[model samples]
Target: MENAYKEIEKGYLNMELLRFTTAGSVDDGKSTLIGRLLYDSKAIFEDQMEAIERASVGKGEEEVNLALLTDGLKAEREQGITIDVAYRYFATPKRKFIIADTPGHVQYTRNMVTGASTANAALILIDARNGVIEQTKRHSFIASLLQIPHLIICINKMDLVEFKQERYEEIKKEFSKFAPKLAIKDIRFLPISAKLGDNVVDKSKNTPWYEGPTLMYLLENLHIGGDNNFLDARFPVQYVVRPQSDKYHDFRGYAGRISSGVFKTGDEVKVYPSGFTSKVKGIHFGDKALKQAFPPQSVTITLEDDIDISRGDIIIKKNDTPKIEQDIDLMVCWFNERPLQIRGKYAVKHTTNDVRCMIKDIEYKIDVNSLEKDYDDKVVKMNDICRISIRTTKSLYFDPYTRNRETGSLVLIDESTNETVAAGMII
Candidate 1:
C-alpha cells in the first residue's frame, strides 16, 4: 500500500494542471457533472465512494447522488445548493485538473468571479428543458468579462429532454446569437447528461447527431500553452534576498514570480518608477542557476549593477514596457456590502505595489443580465460590476487585462477595516 501510494503521488506531480470553473442555474447538475468526471476517471478513492453511498441512502435517494461528492458542506447538502466556491482536485493519466464549482444563484455572483478569475476555461451549463435563461446570460457575460481563454457551453440534463437533437439545436442557436457580443476567444457546445453519466467522460452512444469530442477529451486535448502572455515580460519583485553569510556576503538578488513573458540571464532590463537600467547577471532557483525564467516561475535574480530596487519595483525588457500613469480606468467588481462611494479613498494593490486611490468617476454600471450599461445608476454595491476611473497616489505600470491578465489586474481595500472591497481589470 505504501509503495502504491508513492507511485500515485509521483504520477500526480508529473501531470500538467488545468484549472476550470463551472457555472449554472440551480439543479443544473454542476456538482454532479464534476462528480461524474471524477468517478468516470477513477480519480475518487473507494472510501469516498462508500461515504457518498451512505449519505445517499440516508437521504432516501433511489440512486447514489454523485453531486454529494462535491457538495461537502452540511448546509450545501441539506439545502441542495452550492453557496461558496467548492474546489476539487483530480488527475487522469494525461493531466491534472482543478475544478472550481461556483454557486448558481444571482446573489452569489461574487463567488463565481472569485473562482473564475484564474481559470483557463469556463463551463457554463444550461438546462435542456429551460434552454437559455437569464442565469445563462449572466454567467456567460461573467465568463467573457474575466477574459477566460476558452468557454464550453454544456447543455446538461439531456436525458430529461429525451436526448432530442432539436432541443440541443435550439439552445445552441440561442447561445450563438449572443456570443458575438462577448469577448470569448474560443467556444464549443456539448450535449451532456451529468445525471446518467452520458458524455461526461466517455462519448455517449445516444447522441449520434453529435460529432464533437466529449467534455473529458476536449479538456485533455485543449491547447492551453498560448493562453498566457508570452510576448510581454513583466516581473514584479516580491522580496529582496540578501543572505548574511561569508560565502555570499555581497549577494543582492530580487525575489519574485515572473508574472508573464520571459526573462533570461544577461538580458537588459529596466526598473519601473525608478527608470534605472540594469543587466541580469544570473537567475537562481536556489543553489543552481537558470538560463531563463518564464511566466509563473519563482526565482531570485542577481543584477549586474546595484540599483535601488524594492518589492514594488517591476523588471521588464527595456523596449517593451507597460503604460505608467496615475490616472487609470478599469471595470470594477464590487465585493463588499457597503456601496462604493464616489471619491472614496481606498488602498489599491497592483501586482506587488500598494498605493492609495480615489474614485474619480463612475462611468457606468453594467447590467450583467442584459449586458447594458446603466448610466443612470452609479451606486455600486455587492456583486455590481461597473466601469470607473481612478487616480492613484503613484504611477501604476500596467497593460489592459486583454493584453496580460497578470499585470492588468488589481484590488481595492478599505483601509479602516482592511477588507478587500473590489477587484478591477484595466480597460
Candidate 2:
C-alpha cells in the first residue's frame, strides 16, 4: 500500500499542470462553473459530494447547490457571495489543473490580483442577460495587466437567455470593442451554462450556431509552451549547496529556479551586480546530471571558477543581461487600506533581492471602468491601479513585466508592520 501511494504521488507530480483563474461579477456563476468542472470530471470524492448534498438539504434546496463546492467559508455560504480567493485542484486524463476562483466584489480586487498573478489563463465569465459591465472590464484589465497568456470569455447563464446566438454575438461584439485596448494575446468566446453544465465540459446541443471548442477542450489543448521568455536567460541564486563529505568534498552548486531562457553545460555566464564572468561547469537535478535546463525548472548549477556568489545574485549569459538600475517606473496596484504616500519608505522585494525603496512620484491613476488615466488623482488607495516611480537604495536587476513576468514583478512590504502594501510591475 505504501508503494502504491508513492507511485500515485509520483504520477501526479509528473503530470503537466495548467493554472487558471476565474473572475466574474457577483452571481455570475463562477463557483458553479468550477463545481461543474470538478463534478463532471469525476474529481470529487464521495465524502465531499455527500457533505455538499447534506448542506443543500439543510438549506431546503430542491437541488444540490453546486456553488457550495467552492464557497467553503461560512460567511460566503451564508451571504451567497465569494469573499476570498478559493483554490480548487482537479485532474483529467489529459492534464492536471489548479483553479483559482477569485471573488467578484470590487473590494476584493487585491485578492483577484493575487489569484491571477501566476495563472496561465484567465477565465472571465459574463452574465448573458447583462452583457458586459464595468466589473467585467475591470477584471479584463487586470488580466491584461498581469500578462495572462489566454483570455476566455465564458458567456454564462445562456440557458436564461434561451441560448440565443444573437445575444452571444452581441456580448462578444461588446467585449471585442474593449479588448483591443488590452495586452491580451489570445481571446476566445464560449456560450456556457455553468449551472446546467452546457458547453463547459461537453458540447451544448442548444447552441448549434456555435462551432467553437468547448471550455474543457480549449483548456486542455491551449499551446502554452511558448509563454515564457526563452530569448533572455535568467537564473536567480537562491541557495548555495556545499556537501562537506569526504566522498564528494568539491561539490559546489548554486540552487535556484530558472526564471527564463535556457542554460546548458559549458555556457559562458556572468554573476549580476559583481560582473564576475565564468563558464558553466555543470548542471544537476539532485543526483542526476543534466545537459540543459530551461524556464521553470529548478536545478543546481556549478561554475568553472569559484566566484563570490550568494543569495539574491543572478546568473545569466555573459552578453545577455537584465537592466540594473536604481530608479524604475512601475505600474503598481495598491493592496493595503492605507493610501500610498509619496516619498514613503518601504521594503522592496524583486525576485530574491530585498532592499529599501521610496515612492518617488505618482504619475496617474488608471480608471479601469473607462480605461482612462486620471493624471489629477495621485492619491492611490486600496484596489487602485496607477503608474508610479520608485527609487531603491541599491541597484536591482530586472526586466519589464511585459518582457518577463517572473523577473519583472515585485511587492512592497511596510516597514512598520511588515504587511505587503503593494504589487508592482516593472515598466
Best by lDDT: 2
Candidate 2 lDDT by residue in tens digits, 1-427: 9998897887766677899999875589887888888988888889999999999999999998878888889998898787788889988766899998888777888988999899999999999999999999999999999999999999999999999999999999999998999999899999999988889988999999999999999988888888888988999999999999998798889999999999999999999878999999999998999999998999999999988898999999989979999999999999998899899999998998889998999999998778899999888999999999999999989999999998999999999989999999999
Candidate 2: where is the Cα deviation over 4 Å?
1-14
RMSD of 1: 2.3
lDDT per residue as tens, model 1, 382-422? 99999999999999999999888999999999999999999
lDDT of each: 0.91, 0.91
- How does candidate 1 fare on TM-score? 0.95
lDDT of 2 at 135: 91
Candidate 1: where is the Cα deviation over 4 Å?
A: 1-14
